[model samples]
Target chain A: MTALPPKLQDYLDDFSFITTREERADFLIDIADSFQPVPARVASKPYDEAHRVIGCESEAFVWAVERADGRLDYYFDVLNPQGLSAMAMSAILDEACSGAPLEQVANISGDVVFAFFGRDISMGKGRGLTELINAVVYHARQRL
Target chain B: MSDIKSRGYANADKLVSTDWVAAHLNDTGVRIIESNEDPLLYPSGHLPGAVEVDWVKDLNDPLRRDYLDRAGFEALAGRIGISPETTVIFYGDKSNWWATYALWVFELFGHTNAKIMDGGRLKWAEEGRELTREKPDIGPTSYTAPERDDSQVRAFRDGVLAHIEAGGQLVDVRSPGEFSGETLHMPGYPQEGAVRGGHIPGASSVPWSRAANEDGTFKNAAELRAIYLDEIGLNPEEPTIAYCRIGERSSHTWFVLTNLLGFGDVRNYDGSWTEWGNSVGLPIEK
Candidate 1:
């Protein structure tokens, strides 16, 4: 397993509970465990240029970074997960790519993707944004 | 009691049974807000520990008519003992319409711990849960209200005009009858004779009744997914807007989409048709 990035390492340090990637995944799973979730399918792909990966299904947009260690850092859109206009999706892509070391995160097929995490009573839209940022920064931490 | 097999209620998670609520009626942190805004509906009776909040006056600010007021909402929340860290359980006798609206209002202002009691007061009373005639003593608490995001919500007039110009999805949560021009008595809206007495252009009608059962409680998760994903064809990743006559019914739909279905970008157009039909400059599409 590769080490985490400094920026993402700093974010994990700030959080009182979660630490490792498995812990983060477990946290999401626990939130999903609260509700009886419906069936959902997601489609994912890699953005080689931006040094990041992007995924989308009809329901959500999930973007991530592929590290040299083969770990996937995942970012997702919880607010508008299904389908977004070019303008709206463009803004989201820009926000996700900002300050990140990704070579590119673009909509190649004119389609956007969002990954449905799990049902969390406390996970608001803001948490969704936080999850995406955490995913990207953590994946970028391979060098550390 | 249609079938009463409990497809919606029995299968749902995040739902508090009337028995559960009745058991914990006196929990200190659990503040119940009475959502009966209708004057005729409110005066009759309410659940124990439930405080009244006017859907229009207390919850929303008519001056801007587009968003909720932070100070006004915080004051109301404080008066009801809803601090930022409080767990608010909302209920109402008049179905869950008002209760759901209150839930949406809390979410808009960044109060994430709010939940609507399933079946609301109707199921509680029906199941012999305690009902208090006299209002309870509510100690005021400090609730810091957050500013509502205007981009998340739009007034019906501007929303429709924007839709016509920009072409986003318009989701109308009114009954098929209302959408088809058969207007029942809609409060604070153009009822009798309007220029074009139908829904907005390209607006898909999904009756609010589809969301719940004959009882006031919402349907289960799988059922809701089918209704939104399969039946109504709502895509969670898409930018969608919900609206009703005054945004109450639509707020319920908004709750289902954002809270239950996990659709991130769902916004309720608070002005709804009341502001839309009443506005002269906006184009009317039957």
Candidate 2:
């Protein structure tokens, strides 16, 4: 298996040390607080349906912009104001995948959702978050 | 949405408006509880003085498929600082989907002094109501809960089978795709998909969200009646069973039928399609 991006691995390592649900929730909520939606310069309202993440109830959308160095910078927006999990997953992907090697970004497993959100998440929520990850990976794989 | 009383529900007291909740925010006799499918929702920001009762973590038994027992219920009630007389008002995301689920679980322990906040979290927030990140400092109470009773509002597999055999009313609160066997689960939600792709025999199709308006509040009595009775031909006097993929959605429908529509006898088959679709020799129809 391909190695996960170093920053993502660091996040997983940090999350691994957490033992309680409250701790995990606080950590993820902090990440969610940092989430920034795609700016008007990158994409505005009425985003193209093509970029929408399928299967995500959060109404999340993703975009990948090629940088001068050829690595991709990912931007995301979750339309649902209450979709904190989607926002958190989006923030994590934007941090971990942007400017990373395409191969490493493409190989980031959807299972990392469980690592961040924990297995106790409802089936509907788990599937939606995983689909968010899949959208990012799809963008990376498309450029490969 | 109109006023709760103006909505003309058979039992208007089962639902309280956002205004009612705002007025009762400091009511010592009422406990505001937030329940949601999204775990981060409660921690991020919730109604002031509202405590979170997680559907998965707080309500369900960790080691079993069932709900918490009497002892477990007591522990939870005590932790939430609620007595039998406390009026528990539940509200959350997805049109109070998880809220009703929690309320249903509370009913298992005979916590009947409960009501759903109409329109749930979205409505409250949209109306510019205050949401707080600060958790309340609750003074725990010693709650003496009755034994978990499955007979009143719950249905087992065999009982559902008997209901179908006896020509009882069954409401399948799943999407059209799931009802028609075109999809095993709601579009894009395959994690909870069952082995089979159809619904139980002799069930009427009514997606649970139909019971709610666009603002997350429930439809008025006339609108609900047009769908559940006029459209589906459900008799209010007959014993009825409602089910969905895992019973959460059906709990919403169960609430509508029992409290809003004044159905004489209604039960939620919590096992639902996950159990019926996978069980051996169970009859299913597209």
Candidate 3:
């Protein structure tokens, strides 16, 4: 469970139009109770500063979050696609962090979801893109 | 992007790039399905984790021909390891022509999640993406097909004849030579068919090649909208049927009109030229 800010919480309460509304309501109840921001570290310098990096546009950031049971999940977040800000990426993370029960809804492996999100960003379609963003926001508001 | 540019994507973005798919080569959840004709292409080399599905052998109803019946499709999906939950991405060479047809078949049975990889293997290999010879381990999964969406598919001969008689706009996406009965590509085809060895009455020739660039990626929204709206004068609201040789190329246009362009009532005449060109006693025009 993750604790969500009040503003996000209010947004979830008013969210509609997504199928399976009650699941979202249940998801909201769990996360609003308890959640925290996992610490993420971006490299001090861009790829040009890293002698070992060889790609054209390369940068790396890692996220470490402490679970309720004191377990830690560590992952490397790579920013490859241009115009996709770290803030937008974090917004997606915040949705997942807020207690979406992602495993229950689709069990999409985190890496697969991450890659899918990256591809979606590359395409620039607001159809499924915004829906996914709204899904996260809605989940965060209800659960975290 | 302007509305014209945005509108061009109607079928253009219905594809995923090989470079994009290659980046996720190791993803176990992303299953790739190849609906191709040649056995050499299927087993010899394909994108990593791709399962070959033959349209004639795996998809078509052997008893009925061309049309895929519910039972056959159900078994085919199971054989290809497609589940209701699977995000099935399909692709094939030649402008993703066959792949879009596969997408139509899947969507007709309610698998809207099925997306065609644009540019197909041609672009993928051109970009130096990875391909594999070893087949992935196959799994059996049950697929519950929803009722077929008849509104989006049609048989070639029947569709064209009906359109000619009914005055509906039949858009032929074949080459001008094929439409004029000058240079037929497919072997064992009769030469004395299709009204007068040409397109149906009231039909317009919009070659499938016009839909995409040489790289196989689609023309942007403005470009496609110009061709479909300004150039061809197709209204997005009206009923339109697209057809080409063997129903393959037409699926490309079908993908553009319905999926990318957001036209609701577009159907692909699957029997296409094979059925239309060989039919007895139809009006022919060069």
In TM-score terms, candidate 3 sits at 0.59
A11-121 per-residue lDDT for model 1 (tens digits): 334334544533443443333223221123322343222422122111234444455654443444332211222113223333434344432222111111222211221
What tens-digit string does per-residue lDDT give for candidate 1 at B1-286? 3222354432234345566667777888777777753322333356777777756567766676544678877788888887888777777744577888877777777776877777876677677756655667888888777786455543446555776577676678876766876673242222433444567776788877688876777776678888778876877787788887778889888877776677767778877766666667666555
**Once superposed on the true structure, which residue ranges of model 3 sit more than 4 Å away at CA?**
A1-144, B1-8, B11-13, B155-162, B183-196
DockQ of structure 2: 0.86
Better of 2 and 3 by DockQ: 2
User: How do the residues A51-122 of candidate 3 rate in per-residue lDDT, one tens digit apiece?
Assistant: 221111213243434457533333333343211232233343455444334333232222322232222221
Candidates, ranked, TM-score: 2, 3, 1
In terms of docking quality, model 2 is: high
Q: Quote each prediction's TM-score.
A: 0.58, 0.98, 0.59
> What docking grade applies to model 3?
incorrect
DockQ each candidate and list the results.
Answer: 0.01, 0.86, 0.01
- Per-residue CA lDDT of model 3 for B84-166, tens digit only, reads 77777898755676687788878777777777776676667767777776778888778778666666565456665776788
lDDT tens readout by residue for model 2, B92-209: 9999999999999999999999999999999999999999899999999999987899999999999999999998999999999999988888876864558888988999999999
Question: What 10-residue stretch in candidate 3 chain B is worst by lDDT?
Answer: B185-194
